[model samples]
Target: MTLDDALAALKSHVEEGRAEGMAAYHKQTREVLGIPNPALNDLTKSWRQTLTVEERVALADQLWQSDIFEARIAAAKLLTQARLRPDAAAWALIQSWVPDFDSWAIADHVCMAGQKRLVADPSRVDAVEGWTQSDHMWTRRAALVVTLPWTKQNNPKSDDLAIRDRVLGWAASYVEDHEWFIQKAVAWWLRDLSKHDPDRTRAFLDAHGEKMKAFARKEAGKHLT
Candidate 1:
């Protein structure tokens, strides 16, 4: 089926329950100084069961052309789940859209799933590095979180170390960043990495103790101690 057909099929499934849930979440978010974009959440919950990878990509391109941020986020979600597809285009879209990722939810959705698609490729490291230095806080957080699944799978040591170092370096640089989501992701990355190599994490934290934030140190130490 065509991308338009797939999108229309998916859009028809946007239930009241999903919309209500999204609206409620948006309300809670607004109360906490967060951006309350509901379209992504609503679209995510309405994913189609039969959409093909190419159709999703086409939909993403269409949504991006239309400047529909929520629809693009939904399309990203769909592409991420189409496991065997080449993700170069999706990565390019995310890179171009990184500066626009003002919310932690959308950034996390893109990174967590989009990063999964990049694990086997060496070229993705450079993209992660560039994201680590991005001015956007969520992009920096995405750079760190994208490595989480790799660390957990205990992939080849070479790949693991490259991603590990980038995550730690990003966390170190943002240790004192006041952004709650970035700070929390820093702690979460440390906590996840600590499970893979407690001794190494302890050593790194010890060496960087003075520079590490309290929350991050606490998270890293949860299992190490």
Candidate 2:
């Protein structure tokens, strides 16, 4: 099917799932977060069945331009399945969605899967690193999460200290962020990294203990003795 067809199908699927009065909740979330866009928390429970890589890419392109949050989310879901595809165009489409990310759901949905594609193709790491420093909190969260697979794969080693340091630095900068999502992301990265090297995490925490926010410290405590 063509991109238009895929988008149309996705939009219909999303509209069917839209909840009454959800607009109020979306507005409240935006107001509380100081974000400018309308958001929808509801999402499809499943992806479109077995979409071709090209079809998925087309859907992603269309969804990227959509004003509706669910449309964009649907696109992200489709892209996750296509993450293993070797299409450069598909990767570009995936990368383009980073700046548009506005919520943890979007960041986690895309990054957890797209990260494998990125690590396999190292060129994508630069973009992730750049996002880690972005002013946008979601982008930074995406950067940290995109490395999750790598950390899980290699665990912590002296050789990977630089990577660990970078992740910790990102967490440190955002540890005290008032935004709950940002604080949670900081906690998550610390917790995930701690799984690799609990000792190093303890050292890092102790060294920067005074600097860590209570929430981060609490989360890190899961693995750090």
Candidate 2 ranges with C-alpha deviation above 4 Å: 11-18, 21-51, 154-162, 176-178
- Against the hidden reference, what TM-scores do the models get? 0.75, 0.74
User: Number of clashing residue pairs in every model?
Assistant: 0, 0
Give the Å error, residue 145, model 2.
Answer: 2.0
What tens-digit string does per-residue lDDT give for candidate 2 at 10-46? 4444333344344455542421212222322223223
Report, for every candidate in turn, its global Cα lDDT versus the true structure: 0.63, 0.62
| Winner by lDDT | 1
Best by TM-score: 1
- Tens digit of lDDT per residue, candidate 1, span 46-156? 553455555556666665444333454565576565354566766676566667666665566677556766665656777677887777777787877776775564544
lDDT score, candidate 1, position 101: 68
Off by over 4 Å in 1: 1-7, 17-21, 27-52, 64-73
